[model samples]
Target: MASSPLGRPTRGTTGTNRLRRNDRWIAASAAFRRADDPLVVDLGYGASGVTAFELTARLRRTRADAEVRGLEIDPVRVATADAQLAEVRAGRTPFPRDLRVSFARGGFEVPLADGRRPAVIRAMNVLRQYDEEDVAAAWRTMATRLAPDGLLVEGTCDEIGRVASWVDVRPDGSPLRFTISLRLAGLEHPSIVAERLPKALIHRNVPGERIHALLTDLDREWDRAASLSTFGATQRFLATVSALREQGWPVLGGRTRWRLGELTLPWEAVAPVAGP
Candidate 1:
């Protein structure tokens, strides 16, 4: 991999399957499923490379040749991941022998060798440390390293991966959609997703803002569908999302995805606007 100045190191907190929700979403996305070149980047995959390994395993379900390159700005973390890679390669791990994954030192610049631009770059929880104003520029840097039709999935999630949300951005740095993925088993309300919103929308979740309005509406609908909770959280969420659509909330995805506690909306629907 090409070298670049290492960015500031993060706390690098990570765990196995901590990013399963994000991984599943990427597996279902057209950008990932239809990529002629299935190259994915696990940007800033924290102190451990387990998430990257899980991402590769999940993605391989759809594309056997899927390639996942975990990038970390911390050389120590990179070395750790490289050691894991060595173990996997030597048949000392459970990973497939032909697993196409690697670890390298890089940051928002994504310094890949041979000018390789990935089809998907999942930068989860990496931007929380930066100022909100710096998010756009960081996004632009990553977007510029993508293929023509590539995507940049950036956002945050809880440690155990119960509540998750992310923005799907194009190579030009324009967000296409925002999706919230929840565990739903004990979900109180969909508004809880506000806590895990992408930096672009987290601060925007306030009175009179589009994101706030969306969450408020979701919570209201979720409560309205409380009667369906007797059936199950899945049914309740389905009803709530259905109500959102009926109320003109522009909910995306079908029951198949809704069953997984996911709700997506066009970015324009919740994109931050000027003012509170």
Candidate 2:
């Protein structure tokens, strides 16, 4: 298929399991697990198809019939992923059961053929290279490719996939929630995740903005909950989240999510400001 040109090409810096956190969260999300067709799009999956493959494997556990498509603006990266998948298939070496993973050349506009709108379009690290002003445009372009009930998971993360933050967007292109996930074992501060809270929220993590206020509160709460560190950082995190809840920050989810080093808040809490 002809690749799109809505967005610029990227360096395609991909590594094995670099998107594991986003994959795990996507599979667990209601938008993905109960999709009408279980079709997912892995937008800008870098130079390899491994992340797309992993996304299929993890999502299949919940949907059982999940399919994944990795979209890259660069035709070369798409071809490279296709070659990797072919090599794996040719080997027949007991690979992770991926009945549905494909590579397509596309961009933020997602020029998918057959009118095949995916139920989930996960655009990880795709907007990092663009100006902060371009995020909403990118989100609009991506969300337009979704099914009526589709979701758009857009975010950024570190190299090794230890920490990530994404915004769950509805088909109408409005962001629903913001989530922050961390490695958590020896975590220093829960607010450290502010650095990875998707491109939209990263620079907005300063004074006055809602995201900034949220992080400031989180950092304060983390310090207050440090007493619980005697038990473990996980416990301290839980306490901090609980405190946020008490503060009535419209925090969503609970211990079930907190245990995974995750904290979710509604979109209004972190939407970008009007101007400088």
Q: Which candidate number has the best lDDT? A: 1
Model 2 weakest 10-residue run by lDDT: 90-99
For each candidate, how many residue pairs have backbone atoms clashing (under 3 Å)?
0, 0
Whole-model lDDT, model 1? 0.88
Residue-wise C-alpha lDDT for candidate 2, range 233-263, written one tens digit per residue: 8899899999998998888987988988888
What do the candidate models score in CA lDDT, each in turn? 0.88, 0.83
Give the alpha carbon lDDT tens digit for every residue of 140-213 in model 1: 88899998989999999999999999999989988889999999999887888888889888899889889999
Any residue pairs clashing in model 2, and if so which?
none
